[model samples]
Target: MQNPPLNEILIGDCREVMKTLPENYISACITDPPYNYEFIGHKWDNSEIQRRIEKVSGKGNKTLVKNIPYGSGLAGGVRNKKWYQRNRHNILDYEKWCFEWGEQLFRICKPGATVLVFNSTRTVAHVQVSLENAGFYARDMLVYKRSSGIPKGVNIKQQLEKKGYEQPEKWDGWHSCLRNEWEAICVLQKPLSNNYLETLLEYGTGLFYAKEQFGGFQSNILEGIQRDKTEDFNVHCTVKPISLMRKLVEIFVPRLENSILIDPFTGSGTTLLAAKELGINYVGVEIVPDYLEIINKRLDGISGLQGMLPLSE
Candidate 1:
């Protein structure tokens, strides 16, 4: 099949759109799907807090409150009500949905294509199970550590104090949950042929660029700060930093001149932008029309990004 013109964002359900493309056309996939954690806060929420802190401190504000009480003070009423209805299903149902999409993803990728999926720590195991059940080989897991994170859960010490009970000094450290500082990215691959070199020659997939990884070797842990909402970039709530996305793309498609990357859940087009910056072809599928608008604006702002066209085009 002739390579289709990519570098465009398709506004529709990914499962439906992926079916229209030719089989084994995608070289690699790097995407971040919903973790089924209900209505969890994203990078935009955190950035708002940082903006407020800077406002009070004037500049160079390093200190941040250890904990912020839920519903007490925060933007959007301390929680994302929009996400509440979407993630009401239980874990079992969520995993089943994961399997449905995983099967489709496996069908579209080449023989030895790579797939990198980001999930919350709680649901990483389920995601792995879904992918493995869909016939993708389980590779090593990658960890992305963030420099800052907001801790959530009930404060036992504070509750006891409010109830007029004298708690021991050692109880100061007690809480229902710990601060989340990292997220898990499950690495997976389609089964390759016995001879890797022959597989690469036939399918144009099957190897990782060892030398292109950060610091020579590709460690499981990738450390980076989150992307803040700047004048040119901020559109989605859970936007990842371009630097991190670029690294993942580079590792997946070392020979970018002939490869095409697919982002199934292209929120605000961060992955697409990364592909454009690296001078490669890409296809992004977004369900929300609002997000598609954001993707268009972002792509338009990027200089020298060829094949820039509207969704209708």
Candidate 2:
């Protein structure tokens, strides 16, 4: 595996592919990994909670919100002591899984390289902690605000009424959780080589790109990112907005020659396409072959792209 070809999507487990890569070869890592919730039968999301959800949702199609299915850890079940314990154990497993790949990412990233991970708001902290344990320094979290949200939280009032509790009408406005309107983007950087200045000079990393002269000042809060409604939802369950991905690529990946970006879980090749659109080289790994078809179709649809090849700058 002598520097497996760039600007191509590899078909396999990212953890294994990353393990074979040379150390410090990657300039940045941007990925939206499985959120451990058994999201729509993703094989990687094999959590204890998923089994519980299946039992609750049965074999029927669960109610979906936007692209996210509603059959959560509860799928509308009581959060009793046993449930809490099981959920906690699932979270521990999720964190360990994060560390498993985080270590590989840390190994492959150049010193001072950036890593931006998109995760659910509820579990972002666990991912942050896992990355910290994997030797990446925690920086800050970015918020991607959506125009609308999925009200997936269980309705306590409905539950109370079903339980035949007294005066359930009194809790009309009460609910277990708020509407999910945003996602967490964990910002982290590999340990700098000496200092920021030194690292920037040595590896063209350890810094964020502003270029304020060409655009407005950046903010941690990214607002109003919407998906392409025209996208075929059947192709992939969670296809990220191209605008959002391009914004992220522009900021995180430098345009230096041979600079490479890797998205270990390239669900639909959004990051790779975004990198290609910005003239940055990239490599990706996708576990599902069907999704490789989606990635290829999406990449081929690019105005001047062909055969997963990089566009000349």
How well does candidate 1 score on lDDT at residue 168? 43
- Candidate number with greatest lDDT: 2
Question: Using alpha carbons, what is the TM-score of model 1?
Answer: 0.77
Query: Can you give the lDDT of residue 212 in candidate 2?
Result: 48
Q: Mind giving the per-residue lDDT tens digits that candidate 2 earns over 111-212?
A: 999999998888899999999999999988999998887575668889899999999999898876798889999999999999988887778777777664
Query: Could you give the C-alpha RMSD of every candidate to the true structure, in order shown?
Result: 7.9, 4.8
Clashing pairs in 1: none
- lDDT, candidate 2, residue 97? 83
The digit string of per-residue lDDT tens for model 1 on 162-199 reads 88887545579899789998989999998887767866
Q: Give the worst 10-residue stretch by lDDT in candidate 2.
A: 304-313
Candidate 2, residue 93: Cα displacement in angstroms equals 0.8
